[model samples]
Target: MMTYQEAMDFINHIPHIGKRNGVNRVRPLLEKLGNPQQHLRFVHVAGTNGKGSTVAMTASVLRQAGLRVGMFISPYVEDFRERIQLDGQWISKEDLAEEVSTLAPLFRQLQQEDRAVTEFEFDTAMALHYFARKKCDMVVLEVGMGGKLDATNCIDAPDVSAIASISFDHTQYLGNTLAEIAGEKAGIIKMGSRVAIYPKEPEEAMEVIRKVCRQNSIQPNLPDLSQLEILSCGGEGSVIRYKGKQLHIPLLGEHQIYNALTVCAIFEELNAGGWDFDWETIQKGIGQARFEGRQEVICREPLCLVDGAHNPDGVDSLCRTIDRFFAGKQVTVVMGMLEDKDYAYGLSQLAQRASRFIAATPQDTPRALPAGKAAEIAKSYCQRVEAVDDPAQAAFLAKSQAGAEDVVIACGSLYMIGYAKQGFLREE
Candidate 1:
């Protein structure tokens, strides 16, 4: 038996295995491991953006319905434990450590027998094992990258599959256009599975989803929010009238309405499929469900908000949210992004929303755009673009310039959100 420290060391060493993009790498090992992923009912969500929020919303609704829910999300906002949550709480460190210790040997054997597993595959396996051992009633699993080859797709099938506003993202792995990306996302739509979809823009994305649904004999239902009586509050979340009752979600942004409606659609589908859940519980779950790094409030002194908006769609949503909530306010933005992303487009979106900008590089990632380069790119639109190599320093400058009424938004990548939350949001 390996000690916890030894397990950590072993798993940490596995990080050097580099990125291998394909499903073939994970399937055999998952099969050998008794396919732990098959043990739990799943609500699988895949998309370019809003996947995390959709998962959170669905899990919240399920939990409210009184089911023991397990949630697995990617690109941890704060801690690795955040990736696996039972009900609404983060998994205890001791439990995770013990599970990691027990799984370490299997991880090593898989690496020795086949090729090494990517960090994502290793974590996805861990989440499945953990959720199964915990005997969760349902698990909300978020696809890490593109759906087809994403490690989380190891699950044979899910009770409900959802695509949350697919757009042009992960071009290298998924495809170059919206249709290609939508096709990759549509891979989550299993044959005979019930699906909930937010209304896809560009029309072509919806066509891809519809074609996939027809081919698989899957029922894809696009949520109709016209029936949802929406109440938009300034700077807070939104309240909706669903099934003749009021429900509140502590998340802002109109894009959230689509995610919220997707949750309702999933619940309705599940209910019709013989799963029982009440509307009150669904509302409670939506109100209680929380995920950090998406429009998270870090400081009130100067009203700073940090969101992980890495893609153009996400950036546009963030900008719209800012415009609606903080219009006419002086906004200073702290930004950092991965090199391979559509950094230029994402930067343009953020620059158009922010009055000033500070750029920084996150720790130990080859894909990170250097602070100087990011600042130079941002300078094309904003008059004041400062390059700071350290995230803490960038936050400091953003906060320093922000007045009492001004708003500070730190955004770009999940990597940046992790550091920003730790450096700025970790309140005493």
Candidate 2:
């Protein structure tokens, strides 16, 4: 039996065995493991920005409806175990290690056959196998990247395939244009699956998704965003009236309102398919749903927040949230980003609102933009800019420099937000 640390090490060290061949590389290995995903029901979610929140909201609602729900997300903000969850609880270390032990021999065998699995492939397999063994009634699966080649797309037709807020993030892999990227994300829509889409997506992207749904003989359900009425929105959360029901969403930001509406649209599809979830239960679930690191307020003394807004779209949402809630305030921003992202656009947007800017490097990623380089770019937009190589130190410095009534925000990359949160908590 492998220990938890050993299990994580083994999973993390798995080399990229084959070329990027879509689901072909992972399919055979899953076949050897008894094809566990085929035995599971899924609500497959894909998009650039809001996928995580949508998955969390969907899983929470399903769990509230007395179903055993499993959730699979990617690039966890804090812990590795966060990627795989059941009934809102993370998979235990003991179960993770046990599953890794069971799969080790199969992984070795695949490697010997020139079919080695990547870390994500192994993680997806483990999640499906564990969920199957636990007899979950449903699994909310989030796509890691572009939907067509993402490891989570290996599953069969989902009960509902949802595409949330599409934007320019992975242009190198997905495509440069909105239509092209939408085409890649639309790959998750299977023949028999019901589909839901965020109502406010760009027309170009919507056209591509509409074309795909047309080809599949499916009409995608979209949330009526115009029907959404914001009763109250503050740093705590938002109160919105949707579908003739006033509900409280615990996640912050107006963008989260959009995500909650998308979840509502998804559940409408599920209810139509005979899930039988009432609006009360759905409202309870939405109010109970909480995901960390997205406009998360870690401290209130100096008003420190940490957000994983690495791309232009995410930054735009964050900026709007700030402008709405903390208007006419002195704001200091600690930002970090990956080199592969549109860091310049994100930094420029953040700089417009930041009284001071501290650039930091994201941890544990080879593609992290250098802190000095980010600061140089930020200086073009903000008058006060400093480069700090350590994310935690940058967070601490930002908080310390802000007045008691001022605001300090750590944003940009999820890879660095965890460390920034640690610093903020320590300050608190």
Candidate 3:
């Protein structure tokens, strides 16, 4: 048996199947493990952005209704254990080690198949097995990349499959166009599943979703966007009125409001499907739901906010939120990005709202765009752009120049935000 740290090392080193292409390996791997995903109820969410917040809110609502919930997210904000949780608590290190030890041999055998089992596949299988053993009432599963080939899609079917706001992302694996990306996301809509969609999704995306629903015979569950009214929004978050009831979500950005709307639709769909969670519980869940790395406010004195806005759509949302919340304040951004993302568009979007920009490379990612390259591109968009060695140094240099009221925003990749948060954590 391996220690917890060793088990983590084993899992981390597992190779991916062609950089997020297909889940052929995960299917057989799960089958060998008795297909634990089939034994549990799930709410599967896939999209370019907001999937994390949507999954978190959905899990919180289910928990608020007094049910034991399991959550599995990808590219964890800080810790690997954050990827798998039972009722808000992370999987214990002992449990992770045990699960890994039990599956390690099977995972090795999976390599003999036509395609090798990737890290994501092994992680998905382990999470499902643990969730089944724990007898979770529901599991909120977030698709790691494109839905069609994502390992999480190994589930037979979900009680509710939701597509958060789909946009241009992972263009290489998913397609170049919006509809193509939507089609990949729509792959999560399977047989015997209820579908929920972001009310404001692009027409191209919604058309693809509608077609998938038609083929699967699942009724399209759409949120009534008109009923959602944002009464107040600021650095803390937003208070929105849905129908006649008001709810507050601590996650910043209007994109999160749309995500909450998608959650509301799922709650209604699940209630009609016999879950029966009340409005108060749903409101409470949305309020209590906590997700880091999406406009996370780390320090009030320096007014530091870290957002994982790696893609164009996400950057646009982050910039809009920053503009709304800190309209007249000086904003200095510490940015980083992956090589494959639309960094030019993302950087340009954030640059529109930034008074000063410090570019850095996201820590520990082979795909990271170099700090100098990002800084070079950012200079064309923003007047003041400088390259820093790393996210920690970029944050320090950015903060050094900012006054008390100026907001030090870190926007780019999740890894960048993760590194920036690490600096704050070390202080504590």
**Which candidate achieves the best lDDT against the true structure?**
2
Model 3 Cα lDDT, one tens digit per residue, 194-247: 888988999988889999999998898899877878898887788999898999
How many pairs of residues collide in model 1?
A: 0
Of candidate 2, the 10-residue stretch with the lowest lDDT total is 15-24
lDDT of 1 at 92: 79
Those runs of model 1 whose alpha carbons end farther than 4 Å from true positions after fitting are 1-5, 15-22, 242-244, 425-428
How close to the true structure is residue 243 of candidate 2, measured as C-alpha lDDT? 69
- Which pairs of residues clash in candidate 2, taking residues 3 or more apart in a chain or in different chains? none
TM-score of every model? 0.94, 0.97, 0.96
Error of 2 at 117 (Å): 1.8
What is the overall TM-score of model 2 with all chains considered together?
0.97
- List runs of model 3 lying over 4 Å from the truth: 19-21, 113-115, 425-428
On TM-score, the stronger of 2 and 3 is 2
Alpha carbon lDDT of residue 149, candidate 1? 72
- lDDT string for model 1 (43-112, tens) is 9999887889989888888877778999999888656778889987888767778777766767778878
lDDT of 2 by residue, 1-428 (tens): 99999998998788744466547778877998899999999999999998999999999999889999999998898899999999999999999999999999998998899888888888889999999999999999999888988888999999999999999988988989999999999999999999999878999999999999999998899888778789999988999998679999898898888899889989988888887989999999999997878888898879999999998899999999889888899999999999988898999999889899999999988989999999999999999999999999889888877789999999998999999998887644
What's the lDDT for residue 131 in model 3? 99
